[model samples]
Target: MAEQSSPDWMALARRGRRHRMIFLGTITVFLTLVSLPVVMPYLWLLTMSVTTLGSAAVMQVFWRAAGLVAVLYLALIVLPPLMPERFRTWVPAMAAAAAVILTTLFILPLTTLNNFRFLWNPDVMAAQQGRSSTIGELPSIWSAMGNSFALAGTQTALILITATPAAYALSRLAFRGRETLSRGILLLHAFPVMALTVAIFIQSYWMGLLNSILGVVLVLTTLELPFAILILKTFFDAVPWDIEMSAVTDGASRWQAFRLVVLPQVSGGLIAVGTFTFLRGWEEYVYVTTLLIDNSHMVMSLYLFWVSQDAMGADPNLIAATGVIYLLPVVALYVFAQKYLTQISFGGIKG
Candidate 1:
């Protein structure tokens, strides 16, 4: 072989860059295509929530919102790199403001909140039926929302209360069967709790918690414990032992050291676990439906289900509005907890 005289480094770099660009482009296209099926329904739900199901305005608003999101995404991608490092942090906020302004100008005019009248209108089905005939009336949306909040909130509290100590023990203290117990907890997480619904229901009934939000809360918390413990233990493990030892050496009890020192260190993990636990309880439908016999105990999930069940002549807009409402809390939680949530990793802090 004629010794390759002076390899073209520039050409090789150009080729490598081009290949990376192509690969990234292909992956982006694949992801967008994959996401469309999952995303389009939510877009349609949001559109129908604000506009009549068959109205032309529905499509108009959809396209406008989609266009705005696309533009905002492009701006974040393109503008951030162009900005100085000090100014990069402001790009997201600026993009969000621009999006809001554009939405107000283009999309707001085509949208209406009439479909969400259920918020103030107690008897939605009755109002729709003009009280002359009835397809039966359930509790008010407020009642359902209240119950959902109570269930999710209580479940989160229970998970935090129980999982914290268990995780700390698993992470710090050494004892016989400790390793086995940790593995056992992880194993339990793999078991599908839904498969044990009948047993859970029977147990709830026996405990006199049937038809009660407390029953659902307890059930959800129990099923959630394994996951919560596993996640929290990883956080506890990430806590440096020196910090705890120093605290202990300074005359602090182990519980005191954990409560004050280790606890704050793992705050992100706790929030991550709690956020997921709350969302699980919030969106849970099966257990809530099965355990509770009364409409008064209906959760947002069951409420949305009932609203959607009016297949014969139910207003699709109303169902969509309910869905949008049901989604709001989850969206809000993720938005606020995004910082800590993103830091959660399998075996260590993301940073």
Candidate 2:
């Protein structure tokens, strides 16, 4: 029998690349179609924020810009693999540049433009003032914003302080019922937050924590703890044991080793956990509304609710303005934490 020819490894590799490219293209198209319905409303919201240039004109402009962006985005996705081998290295940089430009032109403008009417247009301000008489005294926007920041900041700090040690132990220590305990913590997260409302209220009332920022912070911290611990634990698991062992050998106490050596390695996880905790606390509504009925302790979430009730006969633009303000801090935090957040891991072995 004739000897079989050796397989063409290069041809097989080329075929694999082609298959991957086709799969990625198909996925991109599918996602784009799925996202259109979700993204259109937000696009319209941004357009409405910017120009009284009328919906028809704004929409026409939006679609044209969107089409151009889609073309560029698709080119970035589809062109790289097809490019000559010598030029392929440039594709990623070009794609990143296009992404940044697209975001700068289309996405970033929305936040700034959301409050344009209130900021720049005198007539719109006058109209808003006229409607204010019909709407009862709205809560101080500044006060509510301050309250929100205070609550979220406090909750985030508490979570980081409490989660780090607990996560380290869970990840590294060999203890009885460790797996069971970890599962139990996660099970707590599955409970509907509303289900705990009555119990929390009673506890708060008895502990003299009712209707206070501290109370809200404590409640949110409790709600956030399980997930925070879980995330931090995964990050801890990713840390190499030998590094901490070396620190211990260098006359560092266990706590010192954890603090001086281990913590720095998992900084990304800490930031990721902190960002999620802060955003949750910032956006919390039901618990805040239930616990703090008065405007004195009202947060931005409650303030937005009050505005939406037509209590101030506020225009859609004004409500959108409040939303923009409310979202800014969260956006800023995410941007600051973006690098760390991307590096967070959940799949390292216990060390």
Best by TM-score: 1
Candidate 1's error at 225, in angstroms? 0.5
Q: Put down candidate 1 lDDT per residue, 1-351, tens digits, no spaces.
A: 898699899999999878977776677678778877987788888999999877889889999888886788666864564457998988889898999899889999999999988787766655654533333457788888999999999999999999999999999999999999999998999998879999998988899999999988888888899999999988988989999999999999988998899999999899999899999999998898899888778889988877766442567898888889999999999998989888778877877
TM-score to true structure, per model:
0.89, 0.81
Model 1 worst lDDT run, 10 consecutive residues: 128-137
lDDT of 2 by residue, 1-351 (tens): 999999999999999989988887788779888888987766566555554443455565467557656666666665765677898787778766877787677655533364555444545544554566554444467778889999999999999999889999998999999999999999987778888999999999999999899998999898889989988888888888999999999999998999899998988788888888989999998899778866678898987776655545656656666666777887799889988777765664323
Backbone collision tally, model 1: 0
Backbone-clash count (model 2): 0
Candidate 1 overall Cα lDDT vs. reference? 0.86
Backbone clash count for every predicted candidate, in the order shown: 0, 0
Pairs with steric clashes in candidate 2: none
The model with the greatest lDDT is 1
Report how far residue 136 has shifted in candidate 1, in Å.
4.5
